[model samples]
Target: MTSLTDLSKLDDILALDLPAPDAGAIEAARARQNDLTKPPGSLGRLEDLAAFMAGWQGTDRPTIDRAQALVFAGNHGVCAQGVNPFPQAVTALMVANFEAGGAAINQLARTAGADMTVVPLDLDQPTADFTTGPAMTGAECLDAFLKGAQAVDSTANIVILGEMGIGNSTVSAALAHAICGGTAEDWVGRGTGSDEDGRARKADVVARGVEQHGHLSPLEILAALGGREQAAICGAVVAARLARIPVLLDGYICTAAVAPLHGANPAFLDHCLIGHQSAEPGHARLCGAMEKQPILHLGMALGEGTGAALALGVLRGALACHNDMATFAEAGIG
Candidate 1:
């Protein structure tokens, strides 16, 4: 796929012919599942997950030899609205922690045996405050989007996407509300341990952002209400799809970041899976709206792809059972 040079060219990318999962591989995997020593359907979602991976990998036996996790960090000017208790500097500080391998995500990625990459999108220049106008200009949003798309490793069998941005929960709420069409309260959630009052303020800010932007195309909503990290997530999702790499989506912020793409085209998420259900209330509702059932529900809301990284272990287990287990004939059973 050619690199995206302009935001106007995004429509072309969305309209490009995308590959579908291999039906033959899916059938072969299902047959193997039935022939396994275990009783039919006993493994439940594991069985389905194995088939899903097989279909994407185009093989009855698939392995995740290399998995890539991307965490995009950006500062949000929306923090000026008092939506977050933490200062904006926290974003840069946390990025430093990620690089130093001290953050939770670093440990999680290491445990999952996935290579992690952190991309900080102009941390010194936050997106414009959306309550007053568009969060980012076309050029700024396009640049961040390209940064995300370029970060994907084409050799990875699977990709996990996440984001880090102070006051980004409000940006997420605004994006979700603009794309999903509900009261701002439906999308706002206490992020970074916001109290009730802070959540209320977030909701108010989201409401104002949506009102200011009004109804628009999904991409337009992204440019209007999304921050740099949010746009990067969207870009990464598209790049992964183009490369035929299955994706594991992280919690609320990550999900909301790509919600606009789903709004533009539901098929955009066909190769994607929700890693977990976030404790943030809006995430479940957003998942329902997107028709995605999460793989795990540990009540995790921490971003940075932590939940997705943990869920990678689940995928690895599914592949292990699918590829290593003996068939009933081989076991001389049944």
Candidate 2:
């Protein structure tokens, strides 16, 4: 695991040697898939998904014995700019709902057999408004990033990451615009039912933030434009990569949270799969910018890792077919 005591160490960690998939295990899994009692390539992406799991898990027969889901929540001060329809207090309320097992993510996590955890960064202390300056100081950003890294269960077969924050869609748009390079209007979206006027406001806020921060390194952009939960998501992604764990990223906000890491090192997201393409307009563009294909397209805009939790079922099904199905020789079907 990489020690991240200071924000300055982040660049070093991003540049450090990282693990790659096990070629032997991947080859073995592919061979097994070909031998299964079915025509070649009949299983479509299921076969590819199984091989992906095998490579990451370093096993021909990869299993999702322990799937973990993490949802990080924080309040963004940019809500002061009226970028969202809901108040920032909704963030804390949603966190409580998650803990009480009443949110969509709770039900989806339970159905998918994943252990769910909700980590709420200081709800009482929202990040500074990025329109005025950096959203978080270096110390604050590093603390949240470390908290995210610490939340990962290294023993799990996979991790699903999601987030909850009012006005964070604006934060995500700002981060995406800063990292991916586009007009603020291109990245802004209607978050939590923002009206046309609200979206315009959001775009203005994102544009101003990017202008104030200027062009900097990806990690610096994160500290300048990202909220606590966004920083945490980036940290969790790094920790998961270090542990060689596969990851399923939720929708727009979650994807944007780690966009900086991708900017820093594209290989940083090699082990991850986008859980879904959100209804949020910027999500599709962001995924396009990163050249990642999402696993589902249910028009879901909910943020609490709900999309990733639901995609867990698809992964479980793929593993089941890969690990439990009989071969042609064993079934005497050849």
Candidate 3:
């Protein structure tokens, strides 16, 4: 919360009580909205989500003008399991693209006026192929969380979480099944354009992981089933909530990463906004588990925080409308 330096243990970080949204600010925002010239509730969920942002900041005027995207990049060893179409090195290549401002997320974030930062993690060699063995050691998973938590910068009040790693969806489905309660078939999906045969194989891989290692503690489950970037995204969610920043959850892999943390602390969901529902099957399950509705769908499955980055523009518009709409008294209409 405090610049993420001098961090405590991972459990200690998650155990800390996050700052609560200000009820008084929320009430005030709602009151002002009633006086606006537009019909009550006409603006609908856009109005609602904006109010949540106001309460999240405990302010009469909430703005996401300075939103930032936290994109975690890493490689998964299970990529060798034939889960993805691209080679795993594309993870590093995409990171370079992000750095070079060449990826879709870069253009989307720029278009939405949000800054982007990439956090890199190394677990490719250490993490076992969960289809055959554990994805990571418990200590490594804890360390990944610590690093992810530490990735938060002081510049932005709203953070959008995204990830890059070949075969991450396989890990995501595995973690979703292990944590959210579902069959591997229910959780697996076509990532990066996998064919029917590929989807079936992915389901089998996830099922094998769950069968061999299931019902561990949330952290252990993460280490056993999730990738390094996924672990970091989980920690980043906790840190964002502690800092009272509205976290924008990206597609399947990103949302899957947050499930464990939300499982540990229900209050953490207060600060999260499902950026959008990813096209991936497991994304819907994650949203169902969280009781969240995706603000925008658009059939997006690209997972560089692209959906979340684009949604920042919508949030900006929502806040602008909330703050700038004329009241009946001001407009002399009532």
Candidate 4:
């Protein structure tokens, strides 16, 4: 089947319409967070939490009734450098597994009690599911980027983005370097277990790809070096923001995928909730460029929302504390 490929058409799709967060609502949520059970500032991230929910639902009491995890899987051309152990073909294989509900991400989404959608984006593959469709053109990439936000298919206010591509870190590094205006040496990392030699080789490949295609626009950079997973996650970021849902970003490849969207629309940040910082050197640089403070910093290199999954509990706890915790006045402790 033909996938979404027109950049402009994708743009139309990504131009999703949604409600904006109410300034009054967010301010009220912020106040509630400050007055939560523990002493003020006791729940560091919880502070960010209450506010995030407020902004997400446009209510002082934001409820995470529904959450989604979008796992985008694809292959990378630059993986030929042996930066990753898995072959490029593994991307298509994993996409099939994701469709079959047999991948790590699938299991984690279940564990997290969130709905999961797998889009077999036409990467080097031939076909995929309807929920997540074909490879994106410049416009298609834009569409894919917007898919996450649109996937909610409702007024839900929480979402998490993940990836399942093989050799995607290579693509991530290339995309990062291109958009961040940094050298490959500054953004390449060992993805899915790359050795030193592999890291060096990956960097060299990205440097060359950058020199060859770096001058292109950010979207073009994504289309050129971008994998199917990157495209879909980008779409997810767009959809999440447009819908006023907070997106919990995953590790290197996943986070890198959102770079173009964030650059294209600064307002996107309003709906983002970073899961954690990874040991991946390039990810730190990307995070820096985004000016985000990750929720966890466990030096995690695993992708597929493993970090996000591990960190989801923290968000939940923060939410619980923000909403259920007894105020100091209620406890009469102070």
Candidate 5:
């Protein structure tokens, strides 16, 4: 794992100004949104979803267009509380599945012409090939999030973030409570299909974690439960914002992972889209706090970017229509 302390090296990169999305292009896309095949205002929020993506990417051609899914995998210290049904080993095992291209995220990334980048964060026993364990410390987490941001900038112009870990929900709830200032009961949820007993345990664990770490700042909260994957993903989002690359976020854990950075950089919200409303209790609160509209409401609790992967399809279709549709003048129908 890369020591979180090395982040000081990236101070220059983090300070660089990012290019802005074109407002003129966004205005044009908004005009085009009303001109789609459907009646005016008929497609509901999706019309807005597509137009915003197009405008932000500066292309009526906005397509989740070159979508990529980066799965941040790690293990949490809180899982010992019986919060997760799967063993901690599953984080490493499934990462192997992700690398082998057999996981759902792999299939979706393939379908969307999106690359799947597997980032292994600091965990007890990390499988090889994931990014070095995240830099430790809140400063480290911030620096690592910036570094992850730089990695995503290298390839995908637009991206998605997913996570894999046995007890990430526990960490996520704690992070949510810390950053958003809510109770553990408000943020905790069943992760990896926990039973009633497991859910109770998950909530209880998060409550304890919150109370223990509640005094810390956002970065401190991350250092406490910010698994390697969570920290890297947070850094990646910072990098994405710095690069101004649009990011589609998966369920609550992945979204919550970036909280510290979000607090540091509120502009981070302008560069992201929340892909789904997770069944997790705290997800809605987080989304509301971010003011992002989740396109899919599948009650999903699966963290492997399955929800984001699915939502990207709808976003892609919206882009296609915006860029390819023949206007009345072009078709000579008027």
Candidate 6:
């Protein structure tokens, strides 16, 4: 429950120069990988991914000991229009589940050696249903975004963003449609296992919202259709990059939040690592729009930072291999 005023605002962070992935660190990692005991290219993409991490961290040695996973939760008024299969109560309940460390993400973070935070952003007052009007005011959207920025742990080199809201997927698609310039029908998908009929109904909701406000700027698009959690995640992405932390992105709703940031600054993608591809229909298109490939394709749509937490282990292994593998000369093998 960090306040928006507690952290540096997204406006301030975006005003500063963002660091790109370091070329020197990347080359150094590649050289060391070639010198490792394994035959050149034997470890496959691990060598490449590890090198990317080095470049991201601006060092030949990249570590994620203080990885931070924040689950931003809130209610969407759009849920009242039958867009969600679940009740709005689930949003508040899940925040409690996160706080108790009883949710799947809690267990996953414990195993990943990452700290977890459940951020309840503006759940006290739900956004207006965008089918009729804007979800929130521009000021509110900026506040939610700043609160998201505040949630990040400065000590964390790896940041994971996820969200929980019943009808958020509908708003996510709406936001994406506005920012990415796609039809609402193309971006909307079933959330919480909505049936075919429910999907169409949800799609119509987004279409109506987008028809009214699709051409607005990033913050305007967010104010028009974005949910509280989505706004926060968007701000978090900007803040993480300001601190030069590599991001581990979750699925559809999360990426939908990401669309505006990508639209505003394509360089933001260079700092993101897609944790997994979601079963949500529009997610692949979202990733495709960013020209990013996910590390896992397990067809997961359960968003609570579950995918990112799972991916942390793989990152840790990559770091281990990069630092511990014996060189060919050291082992007298070449």
Better of 2 and 3 by lDDT: 2
Candidate 3: worst-modelled 10 consecutive residues by lDDT = 1-10
Candidate 2's TM-score: 0.97
Kindly give the stretch of ten consecutive residues in candidate 1 with the minimal lDDT sum.
1-10
Question: Which stretches of candidate 3 lie above 4 Å from their native place?
Answer: 1-10, 123-126
Q: 3 or 4: which has the higher lDDT?
A: 3
The models' CA-based lDDT, in order, is 0.90, 0.91, 0.83, 0.71, 0.71, 0.83
Q: RMSD of model 3, in Å?
A: 1.9
**Cα deviation of 134, candidate 4, in Å:** 17
Put down candidate 3 lDDT per residue, 17-78, tens digits, no spaces. Answer: 67889998888888877788899998898788777988988887887657778899877877
lDDT tens string, model 5, 225-274? 56677777876765676556778889898889877657655665677888
Best by lDDT: 2
Instruction: Give the deviation of candidate 1 from the true structure as CA RMSD.
Output: 1.4
Q: Estimate each model's TM-score.
A: 0.97, 0.97, 0.95, 0.86, 0.86, 0.94
lDDT of 2: 0.91
Q: What clash pairs does model 3 have?
A: none
Q: Point out where model 4 deviates above 4 Å.
A: 1-20, 80-83, 99-102, 123-140, 146-150, 332-334
Model 2 error, position 111 (Å):
0.1
Question: Residue by residue across 1-334, what tens digits does model 4's lDDT show?
Answer: 1122333554443354445668888788878766666667777777777777787677887777777777776665455455677766777777777788887777777887778887666666522221122223565555555554455545655677778777777778877888898778899877778888888888887887777777766666666667667877766666566556777888777778878766666565667767889888988888888988788899888787867765676787777777888776887866
Ranking by lDDT: 2, 1, 6, 3, 5, 4
- Which TM-score value belongs to model 6? 0.94
